[model samples]
Target: MQRMAAIDPIAYGANRNHYDGAVTRLSPYLRHGVLSLKEVSEHVIALVPTPRSADKLLQELAWRDYYRRVLGERGDAVREDLEPYKTGYQPSDYADALPADFLAAQTGNDFVDATVRELHETGYLHNQGRMKIAAYVVHWRRVKWQAGAAWMYAHLLDGDLASNHLSWQWVASTFAAKPYLFNLDNLLRWTGGRFTGCDADGRSPFDASYDELNRRLFA
Candidate 1:
């Protein structure tokens, strides 16, 4: 309740339409051991029988296991910079790259501002939104992946260490060696303009057509 002020059905696990990212329901079950992997998988497989939704959901659970294993093996290296020797790479100071107002949803980039606003007010940003935000933070702002990942960890109630830390590394190009960048057109499409640049001054454009955005995004 403290992490995210409200629940977003769009980011919930029960919502089959949104099975991509943080679903904010596993924390309690994980705490109580009520939703063990075997039990949840058996229940899901039994219900749908050849269900892709079930498959996707199960894969996420597996991801949890994978992260735990990686943490076990690497330990301290998981969060610390892994670049070898001082000669290989220079540590990035991303503080200058990020605009204080922007990360706080104060910057006037209509698209990203809307995104930050949603994340701030609801404590939930969709999977695609997460990628976009990371791209902006790392590629655009040149901030360290660790910084953004830590911020997400602080706020997201369902934040998983493996998913959060490794995924941030992926976005920062530490793992992939290339930060992903999305255009405004693609952003509009993926999010269906649900949260987009509102106006020229970052006020709320809200002028979006779901069908059109989907068509463009898929095309």
Candidate 2:
């Protein structure tokens, strides 16, 4: 709790996307009821003199609250897609279980495999990493979002039904207009080359432009 309380919200807002960003690793505490969203927000507000400095961090807290609101209203329906998938593929088309390669962290994509390994080892993943893996599983591996959600919940110490499942649905295009997809360039830009495309030819599955990705994955 002291560690979370000491986080600099201003720095968090500035550097939260880089591989080594100033994210306050507070979700596990929040998820397990050791901290409350309102308390966290208030603490950030007190530490940061300007409201704008805390806006981004507070916005994240608001997202968590939004998920809780969704869970409250929808109840067990949160286990399923909140809307029809925009992609033409039916729910039945997706695999019932995550593939062996994915579960084993052997997707042959170094960035993805490493993230999965980190999640398994540390029970935590960077938010950006989570989104990328979720997108890869849903759009690239053709696994059902529910399966991926369950896999994540099984490993994540901070896993909450509202945040975990809803975020998966958001990436799967069942809650958003289009599925989230990231390219090799975006990955390199964010990770400072800590992770790279897996193919020796420098053409991994995510090497395409966003337009190409949308066409290939959704068309």
Candidate 3:
């Protein structure tokens, strides 16, 4: 209730994708039934003049409900790929498990390692961090989406089975039109330059243009 009461939907719409933004941080509450989505939506509806003013916040709540529906309909099938790899690599080409180096935050990518360390130390991560890390794991590391999904679900405080797994699927291109990839520019733009994408020894695998990355990772 307190979280919902404090929501600034306009700010959320403008800045929710940034590392530091006016996010409601209400997922854990909603996930555990501390609050209901209906009530939360209503609160936002009453706050703004028109529904459009809170459109982004309301849409995200709707997405949570949508994922819940998918979970109900799909059952455990959500744990497996719903579509074949669209990244020009066969299922056999991807590793079955996350690399030990990745779990240990020793992947030689500063942004990836820093996000790993943050997740280990804190139970929560911003949605952008989740997407970026997911893209890195499933795309760059070539680890199976299930592996990445399980790792995140095990640690996240607001871990909804549907959202966590399906989002990994999206990044893996098993549930989306194409694989999601991020470049050094995108990372720094969202992160506000907190991470330089440079590894400890001054190399950065993420330091490339999107076209260059597309050829390197997917082509």
Candidate 4:
């Protein structure tokens, strides 16, 4: 609780996308109801004493409430796509099972492999890492969003069905206008060069530009 109380919202907003960012690490507590979103938001605002400094952190908390509202309105439909996939493929066209390479952390993308292993070992993943892995699974591997959502729920200590499942659907383009894709350059920039030096390998799946990726994956 001290950690949560000490969060610097300014620092959090600036570095939240980085792998080693200044995140509050309060999701597990919030998910399990150890702390309420309103309480946390109020507390942070009190400490920060500036609307701009606390706005980003509060917006993040608001996403939790948004997901909860989605769950309330949709109920069990949250387990399925809320809208048609923009990729032109139906949910039935994707595999129900995640690939063995993905489960075993051998997807040939070092960043992905390490992130998966981190989830398996730590029950937590950075938010950016989670988005990247979700995009890779749903778009690149052609796995159903529900399959990846289920796998993530099973492992995440902070797992909330509304957030986890809906976010997967967002990445799959079932609830968004376009599918989310990440490239090697973005990965390196966010992760601080930990997974660099992949130019020689022709097998790197995320090395292409966004236009090329869209053509290859969604064409």
Number of the top candidate by lDDT? 3
Candidate 3, residues 1-219, lDDT tens digits: the string is 567778999999999888888999999899888889998998899999999999999999998998889899999999999999899998888999999998999987788888899888997898989998999888888989999999999899998898899888988999889999888888888888889888788977888988888899994
Give the RMSD in angstroms, all C-alphas superposed, for model 1: 7.8
lDDT of 1 by residue, 110-174 (tens): 66677777776776667777787876676556567787888777667557676778777776656
Error of 4 at 161 (Å): 0.6
lDDT of 4 by residue, 30-135 (tens): 9999999988988888887587777889999999999999999999999978999898787788999999988998866677788889999999998988999899
Candidate 2 lowest-lDDT run of ten:
195-204
lDDT of 4 at 189: 84
Which residue pairs clash within candidate 1? Answer: 94-143, 110-197, 111-197, 198-204, 198-205
User: Model 4, stretches more than 4 Å misplaced?
Assistant: 197-203
**Distance (Å) between predicted and true CA of 163, model 2?**
0.2
Query: What TM-score would every model get versus the actual structure?
Result: 0.68, 0.96, 0.96, 0.95
Q: Candidate 1 or 3, higher lDDT?
A: 3
> Native-vs-model 3 lDDT?
0.89
lDDT order of candidates, best first? Answer: 3, 2, 4, 1
Clash pairs, model 3 backbone: none
- lDDT for each candidate structure: 0.60, 0.88, 0.89, 0.87
Off by over 4 Å in 1: 1-34, 51-53, 83-90, 96-98, 197-219
Our model 2 lands, by Cα RMSD against the true structure, at: 1.2
> By lDDT, is 1 or 2 better?
2
